[model samples]
Target: MEGVMALMRPMPVSPKQGVTSPRTSVRRSTPCISTDFSKRNGCLIRAQQLDSTEASTTVPPPVSDSKDNALQLKEWEVGKLQEKVAASQGITIRRRPPTGPPQHYVGPFEFRIQSEGNTPRNILEEIIWHKDVELAQWKERKPLVSLKKALDVAPPTRDFIGALRAAQQRTGLPGLIAEVKKASPSRGVLREDFNPVEIAKAYEKGGAACLSVLTDEKFFQGSYENLAAIRDAGIKCPLLCKEFIVEAWQLFYARTKGADAVLLIASVLTDLDIKYMTKICKILGLAALVEVHTEREMDRVLGIEGIQLVGINNRDLETFTVDISNTRNLLDARRTKIIREKGIIVVGESGLFTPADIAYVQDAGVEAVLVGESLIKQPDPAEGIAKLFGKDISI
Candidate 1:
């Protein structure tokens, strides 16, 4: 019994031997004792607790990601609101296709499937949608700040309205605003030879009051380069930058590129947009040729103050169909009376191929005519202009 008691005595431990005082605590460096079940269980429990703590404390996403998502949501909401406003004003065309779900999640494959929400309803709508994307890319290349700076050295603007009025008074007929068109969506290519400067000079010599240069490249195969080239070539006729003016930035861009006037389609823009854009045009010394197709569109444009030039586009832009009677239908007695009172110069656009066609629109009260395909298709655009007016108006 003495030997067994002596063997069972507790051994003394030094500070370096991994023993802690009763008042202090120290983590164990070695693995849990396998022979001791309690120690093994405690080690497993502590490990699990540490893992639970780490799992509860998750890392947050970057701040920029959250901000970008918020911005996109706001833009989407604003777009929907704008569509509603346009619908209220009887605009059937949408500025862009409706937004859909994330492309990756919508279909089985990586690409998005074609649907009504993502597809354009008509040619006009398709053009507008494409224009929006193209404008975004252009804005990135030439920001508004740079465009504003460019305005300082831009060419002086001519009096587009005065030119038309003078031409009509001198010729005793509707003034001609000849078009420098390369190709149209409906008609593939107007002139295979397609020299913009040459065409502009011919039109000027033929007594064209102003020139319309189609500046849309995707559909029309026209460009700002053509307008600049024509202006640099010393053509006297005022040039109309025939563009789908969606934003105000385009007005500044047009002005810098030697555009004396710009086309503002009433069907594409709202009443408020027309008013605002007209004001901008006034500040920039650029004329606004607000074109209308339907009676409602004409009324909308007529109601806006300070509109000097109103164009009646006889072609249905949505359907690519032409009917000269559209100009006659929109400009009735009451509208004509209002137009005369306001001192507005009415221009009949599209589908005028003959002298009878010009006379019909003039009888309906248009002071000018915008003829493109008929004139540009002929071997001599100048002679085409004479034939269109039924006389040598240049004399």
Candidate 2:
């Protein structure tokens, strides 16, 4: 009993947080299946390994009838598969902590020790981990069935892509998707007296083709209430729910809240996830604004079918670094030809400020720009839009 109890005790804390103690060492026999607990002091902590053949071949039993042991094993297997697939595609941002899943019983003893893999490597990873917990609570409170019913009386979908196209033709410059953001993790409080409806209205009056409302409450200090308010306030511009979407359920949730479009970050999602989410977006009548930060991500997104609008984000979500040149770099000669042929409306997102900045991305071949920090910080976001374009684009 004492031997079993020792295995359950918390690992010794290191002086520096997130740094593993010298006394502890975690060894993986395979990338996803096995963890070597080895010997801790005099205690012979048994290593746990999942059979690769069983993990690959076993069909997960239905959750409704599955035992707790079956469910835990299934979840652990799924997590491993996700990690393996994401790594192959150059995605470093894990969907969950690399600590595998909670192992209720390892061999005969109950094992519940916290592992070093539980620590998030970066800010993006941290946010994603929190989101996993947040979504579980949200799902329990408001399931997909309730959200579908809400959509029955929900506001009619708006033409997000059409609006961008029309705005570009009207202004003879990159169409604007002005953002309604209160604060960002990197920039802190952008607007002291933030009013979503007012800011949205100002953007519409300022000739913004669309409005991107940050819905991430923890990191960006935004909410669905802000999105709903903007729509209910009769803002004419099509609304985009700027969210870190990890699940398809968020599509229904965003649609019910009056989102005409949603943002999908390629850095955090696999190509299969993008395809599946894009299909769901089509069903919900919400445009998917697939965002990419790297050349590999851009290439991955381009290969996906039915992607109408692609946003090149200049800010790296993992590092929160801003560089406008990222926009120009991704839209080089070869990719430019492919994008033109496919008729994809490219939107330059993040780091865009002045008219010169606008011209730089335009010269690189973007038809639209999603600017938030530059416009939302202004005395009037409407005027900020005019200043950004260096001319009045208002209708």
Candidate 3:
């Protein structure tokens, strides 16, 4: 059908090559569209194929007018550009993989939404795809280059790592990195009457060493404004910007918004990305909490450069499965030795609900713990912190 063919035409190569700027008209070979009818001695002749040589050699026509072609071509170019960015950072997972035959049926409209007739296979994969689309829109509003000027006026970074070590020594317990979360995709809304700044103040009064503020607005019902509000409210505990960062630009943006540190998930980032981004964080004076869910992820991060704070997540972000033992398992004797020798501060994350849970991870070698659900749901979050540690940890 013409509709189907129009939607699935082979796209032009990138305009960066100077064949034609995306704003200008694209020149392409037009295919012959005809149907043949002939009477040969009272017998009708069948329609013949178009010139086989031309079909083989000729490039297809522009899918539409200059505007439509430019828009479509720009989308393709952006995908390729992101691919190059990821590849340069040693990442193999592409935002959108190439689909269909190389020279034909090059459009990915159907494949993107209906791959194998299924939605994204896992939550992490689904989140990454969503982030790709979201990042495109965000870049249109606040391009990365524009954020550099904002970075210059950003608030000074705090000693996130040093605070945790000091708290651990002072309390003789794992330092609490209290979370200010409204909701999560796994457990839905944890608190309907959530006030982020109020919760942050409670956590601080309850003796939290640091605060992890969820800045993702979609799945977590959180916002960067919360981080700013907490900072302005004079909560002295250093704030960690908890966001799904897919590019280096977000680090500078987080600093501008009053983050003392930023979380980096090892499962989502390649080793090279961690290394490169860690350098960027150091340059910006923002501490990076490199998070891992398994031994493989842990091992990969340990090999990276300038990784000071490592958080072992007990919940698998992909399947949403919780196993508090994950922290203990990954922190085996060998890994523990390496982590200690390297001066890497391990922060146990997720599924920690009680004093026993706190004690479990502490014995497993975590100097700090990032906890949310159990503490946030209590009638008084400050009391919840006391319950979490079985004593007051506030200074």
Candidate 4:
């Protein structure tokens, strides 16, 4: 925790009325890793795929998009299958209309310069570069390789999720560490009036095992600065930095924000990336709550050794839709076997507002819960936390 304490940096956020500048800064020196990967194999793979794709009837890129990038548009059509499945289930699906093609951000990789035939190397890149955007990591200031060693590497500091696992092993119900998120892209503006320090105090008073803060500024309306304030205000609950982690740089950054744990969405990354990133989170003394929404994501996580905490997100990321039933759908009987056998601490995330909702997921097997809206709306956020817990947190 100390290793990461000096690491959590103050995020860019507007200070609330009563809040003032923090007397301390949480900046840690970072060790760097090489960001360059040779694209020779990628080019070969693309050439072969392009030849095969071209052999089939020529599918031109959508007129709305660039002509040279035609194949990517065609591939984007396939990613929509997840949406199709949700709609078929009679779930109230509010599909955000197909977005106009987006420009891609090219990463600073050397291999990107060489044109492989025309295909994207992996699915991860497909989601990233589908818009002709640069898909490589660039140095905002320092390269990844250079940041690999200058900083002190921290070890995994298990938090609420970990504590829950311990409780379950002891008495079957791990503690509930609910969130205080104000908004998410999937369900915009979760709570109208939000205060971080107050909410953390509420969660603590409500008997919450810990607090999870959505620190992403763009999508979540959350900030690391809020976390820093939450830390400075002297809350006892540990904080989870809820952000889209596209880089390990963010993990290092999370510790600087006084985060005790961090979320890693499984679908957005490959298996190798998950293993590597989770390991990195441990090295930084932050809890890595590896999240999964599907069997595939679960399988990837299960394959990794020594992973103690797992969260099942009820919300779909691609479509930004919440499916509370996802809690049940994901944790079937077979899953129970693996969970119980391996002692994996499972958490159900999103769309939970009531004690009944908490009971539903808890009955489904999640010993812990993560929520936002319901608690935020309450006059006393701590009471909301207790209500969600179905017990007196004030006790």
Candidate 5:
């Protein structure tokens, strides 16, 4: 009688919640399964039913649940909004980061789908894309919030434009902005035995009005560490942080690193960014060198307010093609008249290697010349300076 009572009681079950009980027979395939709680028997109800034939072969789960689908839709919507924002800002070539449904975790086998803008069409586009990813990763490590605090303790900025004017007055030529470059995309490596501090000192001794230090690590093999070291080493020449700046954060970051001046590439930045960044530079007491390669860019930049210095780049960054004549061509009667009227100091940049090169740009009405490879590659960068001007400008 006790054994009969024991049989009436239910059997013990395992503590694991989602584990199914072992069964000898497979459940039959049902026509439909409703998740509505009202239809549930209030007891054991199967949420999923598998056929006996399908039991042996694995069946895949749904691609995504409603929650995941909703998230994907939100991400896509945000991406489109960002695109619109970029377009309105005059950033035609800029691309937003890829966003979509979260990828499924497949062990030991990774699957990835290429999206639009994931691959670049040209070298210029490639560099911009790479810069976006690099800058994003860098921001995570040294956020703008932290950089702003560092600015409070940063060193005072020097007179970059004044230095150029003074040097021109003393030399009767375009003031030299000697470049401390280790490498370039067009010319692979300028100096295999590159030493930033040493190069800076040589440039100073050579009587450079200012120094342009390449702060791009990936392509130029330069870093802010180099800029700081040169500043800390008692070099008095105003240091320019040469960088491919895409965001406003970099301007603040450059100030924190002891930069007196920063390069603004017109091709890579929108007119709005240049205008806003120029204001930020004034507030920070840093000089902004607004660089342009075409007539359209010059026209766009000239229209902006408070631009003090403008650089005419001889080298076409997009094509890597250079013609020093670009300087004379850009500063035609109309543009030169406007520049002179605005009191804007014109800087001739790139493709400058010799005294003739310097003279040519100066005749075209440039007050300064930013030189790199030819000066940096010399056995004695200081001697390279005297040769550059065809005379000893230091005296």
Candidate 6:
């Protein structure tokens, strides 16, 4: 033991013997995984002894989750992940916040999928994606034709189209577009008294330049009865048939339903579709409001010929994120040269609250707005229009 300590003292290799050989010294300093490392999941490694005079010390083993180590490990568990779960018991684990379903989106992008050991992603996402694609393929169908024809020949005096435009010009900013909804997808019931004629009268009194009547019965819970009611009610304001225009049958149906206008979503339709629909709208004496969300959609809307009204929607139809700035961004894209030449009517749609929001979009280049929530929430919807416009232009 004395000779061992003496040897280790000169160039210490072992604590007990202190035998100093170059090979042993080199081997001693090399990193070694604790024989008991895996026993406790890489914890409880006690340093035994060291010869003080040794030039080098043993390198600590790199932390790992490989089967080469003693601890039980999964193939997927590696890197920083191995550090997530501790070696000791009675200790809580901290996890990186989950990559859960998306909250809001700005544009189209593929979603991230997570699964255990890569078994396979659930079919639910695939199903939804397929449905989205199916909806995209519905481009072949056009619903604005016969409906336009019916509207053009509608008995309620086709000459009254000028009056509606005149009223919009007469009214100031955020010019009124009153809603005639029997029910909505959200609240279900809109007007319990639901008289289209009476409601039209009230809206007219309320100073509305146009009326939006939900005609989609499946979700919105509206009916053509309301459209006929308003049409026969002799309410002067032009009517926008709020229908899911998936098929051309809907447009013709809209004419029979007594609508003076229809919505054409740019996301759902290509430029050719918009041109065809807008042309149908003109032929049928209906005004078309080409609605867009993203810059791509705005560009698509602009490509359509004979487009007079372009609606920039804050509420996204797919994910339903309502960003008010969406309207301004789209409106700002319009060059002064194009706007003056086309004389485009820009309508800001949805998610408007205060007069400030109204004024914001109007200043952003919108001549009129299609407001629903703010006006509907009011005690007197007619008076709501007055509050929005800041003046009474009720006829």
How far residue 53's Cα lies from its native spot in candidate 1, in Å, is: 46
Better of 5 and 6 by lDDT: 5
- Give the TM-score ranking, best first: 1, 2, 5, 3, 4, 6
Candidate 4 ranges beyond 4 A from true positions: 1-158, 165-174
Question: Candidate 2 residues 14-61, lDDT tens each?
Answer: 224322222222232211212222221122223454343422232222
Better of 1 and 2 by TM-score: 1
Task: State which candidate has the highest lDDT.
Answer: 2
* 212-274 per-residue lDDT for model 4 (tens digits): 887766556888788778877888777788776756777776675677888887766555556
Report the C-alpha lDDT of model 1 over 290-362, residue by residue, as the tens digit.
Answer: 9999999999999989999999999999998999899889988899899999999999999999899989999
Q: Model 6 segments beyond 4 Å from truth? A: 1-153, 156-165, 186-193, 333-336
- lDDT against the true structure, each candidate: 0.79, 0.80, 0.75, 0.60, 0.75, 0.55
Worst 10 residues of 3 by lDDT: 36-45
TM-score of each: 0.82, 0.81, 0.76, 0.63, 0.76, 0.59
Pairs that clash in candidate 5: none
Residue 231: error of model 6 in Å? 0.5
CA deviation > 4 Å runs, candidate 5: 1-92, 95-116
Q: Highest TM-score: give the candidate number.
A: 1
Per-residue alpha-carbon lDDT of candidate 6 for residues 34-94, written as tens digits (9 for 90 to 100):
1111121321112222233321232222234555532222211331232232212111211
- What are the per-model numbers of colliding residue pairs? 0, 0, 1, 34, 0, 6
Query: Over the stretch 1-395, how does candidate 3's per-residue lDDT look in tens digits?
Result: 23322423444555474333333332222222111112112211122222434233323224555797557656655555545655655444444323211222323322211221113445565566567667778778887666767776777888998899889999999989999999998899999999998999999899999999998877799998999999989888999999988777678779889999999987678775687678778778889999988787888888886789999999988789999999999999999998988999999999999899999999999999999999999989999999999998877
The global Cα lDDT (0 to 1) of model 4 is: 0.60
Model 5 Cα displacement at 240 (Å)? Answer: 0.5
